[model samples]
Target: MLWRRRAGMNGESDLAIHGATPGENIDESVRALACARHLPQPHLDRWLAMNERSRAAFLEIAQTLRLRTGQITAALELLEEISVRDATDCADILAAPEIARIRLHAGSAPARARELIETLRARRFPRLRETSTRLAGAIRELRLPRGISVVLPRELRSDVLTITVEVARVAELDGAIEALAARRAAIARIIEMLGGSE
Candidate 1:
């Protein structure tokens, strides 16, 4: 037997129970966890144990709930940190009842605990992730022999770059200047690739 709370078109919630074989129970339970507005603890635990898809669905529902409750910024940030794998196997995170429990225990503002479960979802998109990785690698490869540190512009915008060069005397200053001069073309190319005009 599996139990779920269903919301009707009239905005009322009803307890829906299904009695069936174990496999059927699991399916019904997963469905309930995916759609239910409120999750009872025991049922949440059962839903967490079902399978990967069910856990992912539960996390999605939890995210929706957070958004509807005006935790938009926090929810967006949390989405960046949450992964489907964490949603499936990590009971302390992406588990609705557990999140609610943590919320109560921490006495923090809404969506505070959820931040801990956030995964870098931007890295999941192949093109964006690939571009970011390539850009970072290219930047690292431009390291100067004098240990000049190149700071990437925030958001990779390429408008402003900060280069740190350590020099203790006049001779080192000349070397640093020459090193930077040598790398000027490479740096310009990198900036162009990042969508900035030299």
Candidate 2:
């Protein structure tokens, strides 16, 4: 399909998708970029399926952020899911504070790209994000001594809590053990939270 854009009343440029008929002044700019990046056909189809504003918005993001193939795919899927769940537009999703901060503000592009995906994931899974936040707060509340770490399962996908102690000496190890024991009740609360105990 041919891609073009026009200015919206809000000053936002909107993308145009045209049928792939012969001699229609096709706009291959976006398609060329997608091809250069080796974007998978299925994902490319998904991209093409998005509305004009979303297509333009995502195109701007993909270009500006230098999103890799995998990142593009993940971001697209997350955006699609978020739109379906929230009944919102992809452009609106990209405009969110957390996303816009990373997109419009600056740091490493790779880091921002990763953050963009993660931010979208958080949006897509609000409850999981909330649970993760609460669990992280609980972990911080423990105030375990240095060299001791509380590890929660990735995404809290399972009811597993891993406690690690790093000590260079028997004395340090003993102190770590003591510190953990002192925080046993607090730590248990964290474990209970992980186990869906509330």
Best candidate, lDDT: 2
What lDDT is obtained when candidate 2 is compared to the true structure?
0.81
Clashes of each: 5, 0
Estimate candidate 2's RMSD in Å: 4.1
TM-score of each: 0.42, 0.80
Error of 1 at 63 (Å): 15
Q: Model 1 — which ten-residue stretch has the worst lDDT?
A: 67-76
Over 4 Å off, model 1: 1-120, 123-127, 196-198
What is the C-alpha local distance difference test score of candidate 1? 0.52
Clashing pairs in 2: none
